[model samples]
Target: MTVLLVDAANVVGSRPDGWWRDRAGATTRLLVRLAQLPERRLSGPDGGVVVCDGVVAVVEGKARDVPAPDGVRVERAGGSGDDALAACAARLAQEGTPLLVVTADRGLRARLPAGAAVAGPGWLLAALDETGCVPPA
Candidate 1:
């Protein structure tokens, strides 16, 4: 199964939707949108197809309190969200699960385990738009 790990802060921040005003609200909206998505078969940046089987969002700071929707799992970071994401990625990689991390942070991208596929927030946002999962901006 291909697991998609989302950097909630990064993805939410990618869009200048005024997420900074209310981090928790923005996170909740993002999670709700994610829950509404049907199983997706997306084109990877490397010209391959990526089938997203499961989704996990790592939340931190003010957004940590946002509850997860039915189809999404929320991981609250006690401190650094990037650290939490890296740990999750490492664990998933060790289990031999195909992993895809969604984020635009170069440092976090560098920290991900080997064999883990990485996609930027633009990729995710475009997919959401294609599926009509995002609200009108």
Candidate 2:
């Protein structure tokens, strides 16, 4: 299965879109977008494969309790989001699943398994927008 790991704080904070005021709200919005990602299909030469089988949103601080949508899992980081992300990635990698980690933090990227696919926040945001799943303001 294709596992998509999202750094909730990093993705939400990627743009200066006033997410800091209500972190939980922003995280909820991101979860909505992430839920849509797995349903997205690329056409034509891309062969119409689904983007992901599941999405894991690693949330911390004020965003920990955001409800997850179907096909999405929320990982509450009682401490560091980066640490939680690393742990999640490691677990999935050990299971031999294809891992795609969404984050812009270099340090977090360094912690992922060697074969984990890494993409920046803008990449995910653009894909969400393309699928008409823009995050709420």
Candidate 3:
């Protein structure tokens, strides 16, 4: 089984898609895309989790609520979003589960456990496209 930990903020902020000006829109698109991941069969065996640095909800400070796909969970970064992701990957590695971390940040990529697969924003965009999450031209 393979576990995927996503740096949702990085994925949302990656491309020159005007995400900064439309953070909510970008996040929606990213979340929608993430929701499609398993249906597209792109997620590995263990499933995926989308982690962000901000609060998960509009009213809740401790947790924000985001729509998670059938096999995905949306989580706030809390202490350290990236740190949590890295730790998840490390735990998976210890369990002999293949780990895949989705993000374009070079530093975060470097911190991943050995044997974890790395994919950048471009790759995620492509995957989303494959799943028909990216709007049609």
Q: What does candidate 2's lDDT look like per residue over 16-118, in tens digits?
A: 9899899999889889878876755522122334356778889999999888888688999999999999999999899898777889999999989997888
> What is the clash tally of candidate 1?
0
Better of 2 and 3 by TM-score: 2
Report residue 2 deviation for candidate 3 (angstroms).
Answer: 3.5
TM-scores of the models, in the order given: 0.92, 0.89, 0.69
Best model number under TM-score: 1
Clashing pairs in 1: none
Pull out the clashing pairs in model 2.
Answer: none
Every candidate's lDDT: 0.86, 0.82, 0.58
Best by lDDT: 1
Task: Name the candidate, 1 or 3, with the larger lDDT value.
Answer: 1
Ten-residue segment with the worst summed lDDT in candidate 1?
128-137
Tell me, what's the RMSD of every candidate?
A: 1.8, 2.9, 7.0
